[model samples]
Structures are given as structure tokens and as C-alpha cells.
Target: MVNLLPIIKQTLLITFFVMSMMLIIEYLNVFTKGLWSKGIEKSKWKQVLLGAFLGVTPGCLGAYTAVSLFIHDIIGNGALVATMIATSGDEAFMMFTLFPEKAILLNVVIFTIAIAAGWLTDRFFKKKFYIPASDKHFHVHEIPECTGFPKNTFWHQLKHITPTRALMLMSILFFVTFITLDEHLASGSFHGILKWGHSSHSDSDPLWIKITFFTVISLSTAVIFIVNDHFLEKHLWGHIIKRHFSKIFLWTFFTLLLIALLMKHFDLHSVIQHNMFWVLVAAVLIGIIPESGPHLIFVMLFASGNLPLSILLASSIVQDGHGSLPLLAESRRSFIIVKLLNMAVGFSIGLAGLALGI
Candidate 1:
């Protein structure tokens, strides 16, 4: 029972970030009237590059951004694939700590592969995966509520906050408070709750992560404050929270918990210790998981000289941390396709590297 606490904390953190990104994107689309969407729609390669760049940014934040962008139709299947390929999830941080020089090289290779793979996916498989804007099957709920600023003053709106508004405010505040307290605790006894290797960043949380968290939370809070009753009830609460919250939370929690159980009950370490062939296979298979912690085994093994770069590369290429959980909620088909594509790429490159004795 006690073993599950850290998993809960991790799930909460992932859920909060995913929800915040969704809200932020929703706010941007409403306010900017899809200006950002229009820009990305012009060129496929442009979207692919943006996705790779975001994917390479440390942690799962960039992957979350890419998923949000894809859901809003600001990007396509190719770009999402690119983001997943380039992203090593939280394992990238561990890699940097374990083997800085090799980590740099590995990331560079993955980035290049991500770009190529993304461009190829768009060129060959675009039509098969393209979800038209009018496709209701893949559409996010669109409430016909007024999205303009409330006629009432901010204070007036605050005073008359409805249940939905109150709920949203409390949820965001709780997430913020949890993050603050977690960081403080992480610096002391709970330092490794979120990490396996020593972090390269000076702070408990990365600087850019702090910046992104605060910026998005601020925007979301401001939106909650000024949006009218209809928008709050229909769009923010109904569409964003009701449609997404439980799915993301449940999927993330169960998936992480299942992986934790597997690692605990199964003697995977000894299995990997025996054969290079099985290790390569295991690396690819585990990389299929949508969580982060499992991939760190490869990182640790590589750092300890017990695993080769080829296996680690394959694992990194296929696994994308908790970044893909939102996509899982949005469209299971898309998530499967992305993972299959990544697996193919990871295995091909992994085998090639092994052949060359990398």
C-alpha cells in the first residue's frame, strides 16, 4: 500500500500538467482565433520541425505541448510521431546525469531520426491518419457558449462564482500548492521520488519547467477569473474537465501502477543480465510503455557499462514517458499507430547500431 504513494504523486503531477496544457491551448484558440493553428497548417515540414524541437526539450513538457497542438489540429500525425521519437521522457535527464557525453550524442541522433521519420510519415501515411476538422469522431467537444470577457467586473464575477468556477479555481490552486510542497520535500528526504539519477539541473525542478508551469497556471487562472458563466460551465468545466480529467487520470494511474507491479514481481534485471539478444528485445518491448520509470533501467545499465548504447537508443526511441497519455485519451488509434511507428524506427536503428558495434 505504501509503495503506491509515489505513483499517486507522479500521476497527479502528470494529470495537472496535461490539464493545464489543454486549458492553455483552449484559451489560446479562443483568444487568438486559431492564429497559431493557421501558421502551422501551411507546411508539413514546419510542423515536423516544431514537433522535434519541442520533443527534444527536456522532460515531458514539450511532448505535452506537441500532443495539445495535435489535438487542436495545429499539427498532424507526422509531427506527433516526431515528438514521440525525439522525446526520451524523463529518462533524458537521467541519461544526462549518467553519461553526459553519450547522452548528447544519443539525443542528436534521435533528433535527426525524428525529423526524418516525421517527414516520411507525412509523405507516405498522411492520408490514412489525417483526421479532418469536420470529423466528429476525433473532435473535442465544442460548446456554443459565449467566449468573450464577462460583462461583469472581475471582482463581481469572483463574488458570484458558480460551482464550476469554484471547482476549477480550487483544483488549479491545489495543483500549484502540491508542486510547491513537493519541490521542498524533494530537496530533502523525498529527493528521488521523481528521479533515479542525479539531476543535471541545479534546482529540484528545472528552471524552464518552473517558468512553463507558472506561465500556464497564470493564464489558466486569469481565464477562470474573467470568463463568463456560460463559458465556465460549458467549455471549461464540461468540455475540458468532464471530458478529459477522469480518462487521463485513470489511464495514467493504472498504467504506472501496473508497470510498478511488473517491475516488483518480475525478475527483469536478471533476465537482462543474461543475454544481449534478449536485452535488445526487452528494451524495445518496455519502450512501448507510456510511462517513464521503466526506461531508466536502460539508462542505468548503459551508465554502468552493463548495457550498450544501441539498446538504450532503442528504448529511448520507443518510450515517450507520460507524454502520450493525453493522446491515449484523445484517440486510442492514434496512440497505437504512433507507438508502432516508433517501435519500427527504434528497432531498425537499434539493430543497425548493434551491427556496427556501437
Candidate 2:
């Protein structure tokens, strides 16, 4: 327990800092909203540029939410691809926390490449393939109520950013950490428990072992969340977390943590080292997953190793996930087709880059 204190403290501190930065950005809204609104009205090139900029940061859900907010109005269609491609997901912070030097540079490179490719694709292929039906046109007669700048004062903002919200956020972090720790702890605990049971009962089929193991894992996770919630409310941390439950921050953090755990457990580094070509192939074939977090996780894994730069660059071009699917679902068949073409072209470009050693 004593050993866990430092890790807990570090996690809490990182979470607080990230939240504070997001709050500051929200308060400013000038950069985010202004750039978005201004860029959307311009050519596809400008929209792609804006998308790339949005993607450089790790807020995949926030980006989508922003897109959804603007979908009815000011934004263009191709911008979605650009934004989705460029985002690194919130998990970059976890990389920074664990492996700062490599993760930072790798993320920067990935973001830059994704943005540039997305912008270019949007510029050349605007509305060429995927066109919405007449009833499903992309226009904004009136800006949605949620589409405007935030209207909170400095004091109001400060008042809302309390320790309770911080605590809630911390509780969420703790839950994630607990799962990782529990995985480690259970390996030993289970071995001992099974050994003890073996002496008492022979010929016990291990048929139920897999089922019970998973059940215990699921139950343990639920218990952690419940306990964290209860404890937070009973303490000052609860108020802080509650006060600052910004969806963007929460989602971003969750995404980042997921990526970190994936990398930690999956031996992604070794996979990248051996099958670098196939990894990039997967990127080109699948393009971006709908969610930025999942997409970027693959990107980061590829980037962290000696994968060919061309493959890396090419993989970044295909924007998948959040940007394409929702639009396809909205009867924008032309847009969907255009997105697929863009992805194909992006993949080709990556392949060409690899072939040319450019």
C-alpha cells in the first residue's frame, strides 16, 4: 500500500494538470471556436487544415462532438476526415507519463502527418464521391443552441472547477489503475487459492475456471467503481471531480489510458519490430477506426518502433471511424464514397512513399 502512494500521487497530479489546461482552453474558446467557424466557411483546403489542427490534440470525442455541433451549420463535409486522421487520442498523456521521450516525438510526427494528408485529400476530392440526398443536405439554416461560445465568467468558471470534480476524476483514474494492478495481483492470488483447493478436491474439472476468472474480474471492476464513488462523496475529492466532469477531459483521459494499457500488455513494441510491414498494411487497409482513440493507438504503436517512415506517413492519411461512419449513416452516400476513395488514395500515397523511400 505504501508503495502505491507515489503512483497514486503522480496519477492525481497529472489528471489535475490536464483538467486545468482544458479548463483554461474552454475559458478562452476564442482559438477553438473561432478557428473552426472561420475555417469551415472557406475552401475544402481550409477545412482540412482546421481539421488537422483539431486532431493534433488528443480529444477525439470532443472533436466529434464539436463536429456534431457544427454539422447542422458552419462546417463542411471533408473536414471530418482531416480531424479524425489528425487526432492522437487522449492516451498521449499516458505515453508521456510512462515513456516521455519517444512518445512525445512520435505523437508530434503522427499528428502532423495525419493533418497534412487529411487536408490534401479533402482539397482534391471534395464532394466527388459521397453526395447526400436532397433531404439530407449539409447546410446550417440556424446555428444550433449548443454551437456557440461558452458564456461563463471567470469566477463562475472557478466556482464550477472544485475539488469534488477533481475527486470524481481521480476516482475514475483509480478505477483504471486498480484494474491494471488487480491483474497483476490476481496472478499470484489465484495460483495460491487454486493450489489450496486442489488438495481438498481431486478430479476437479477446470471447466469453470475460465468462467470464474472472468466473473471475478468483472465483479472486481464494478466493486472498484462503486467503492471509488462512495469514497469520493465521503471525501473532498468527490466535490472536486464532480465540479469538473467535463466530458471532453473524461473521454480523452479514458482513451489515453486504454492505449497505454494496450501497449503495456500486448507487447506492441515487439509486434512493431517484427511485423512492421503488416502493421502499416493494416493501417492502410483499415484506415482510421471510427473512434480516434483506437485509431491512434495503432498509429502510436507503429510510430514507437523502426517502422518505415513511408508506411507511417501513409497510414496516417486514411481517416476512418468517427468522421466517416456517422456521415454515412445520415444518407450521405456520396460523402461516404468520397471518404473511402480518400482513404484508398491515402493508402496509395503511403505505399508510394514507402516504395520511393520518400
lDDT by residue (tens digit), candidate 1, 1-358? 3377777876676666666656655655455443333477778888998889777766665687777778767788789999999998766755553355677899999999999999999988856453635534333323222357856567887887787888889988887787777754344312233342335345454554455557867987888887778767866787678876776667656755654564567554455556767778888999888987667667655654556789899998999987888788777888899999999999998888888888
TM-score of 2: 0.50
Among all windows of ten consecutive residues in candidate 2, which has the lowest summed lDDT?
189-198
What are the lDDT scores of the predictions, listed in order?
0.72, 0.46
In candidate 1, the residue pairs with backbone N, CA or C atoms under 3 Å apart (3 or more residues apart, or in different chains) clash, namely none
Per-residue lDDT tens digits for candidate 2, residues 1-358, read 1233333433443454444333333323322444345435646666666666665554333354435533544455556655655544444433343344555565576556656666665566555333333445443212212232234433453455446545544655664465347653223322122121124233432445434444433543332233222332432233223444343344444534554555546765566657755766777666545443444445344433435555655555554434444445554653455457556656776667666765
Candidate topping lDDT: 1
**Candidate 2 stretches greater than 4 Å from native:** 1-36, 39-44, 65-78, 91-163, 166-271, 285-288, 292-325, 331-335, 338-342, 345-358
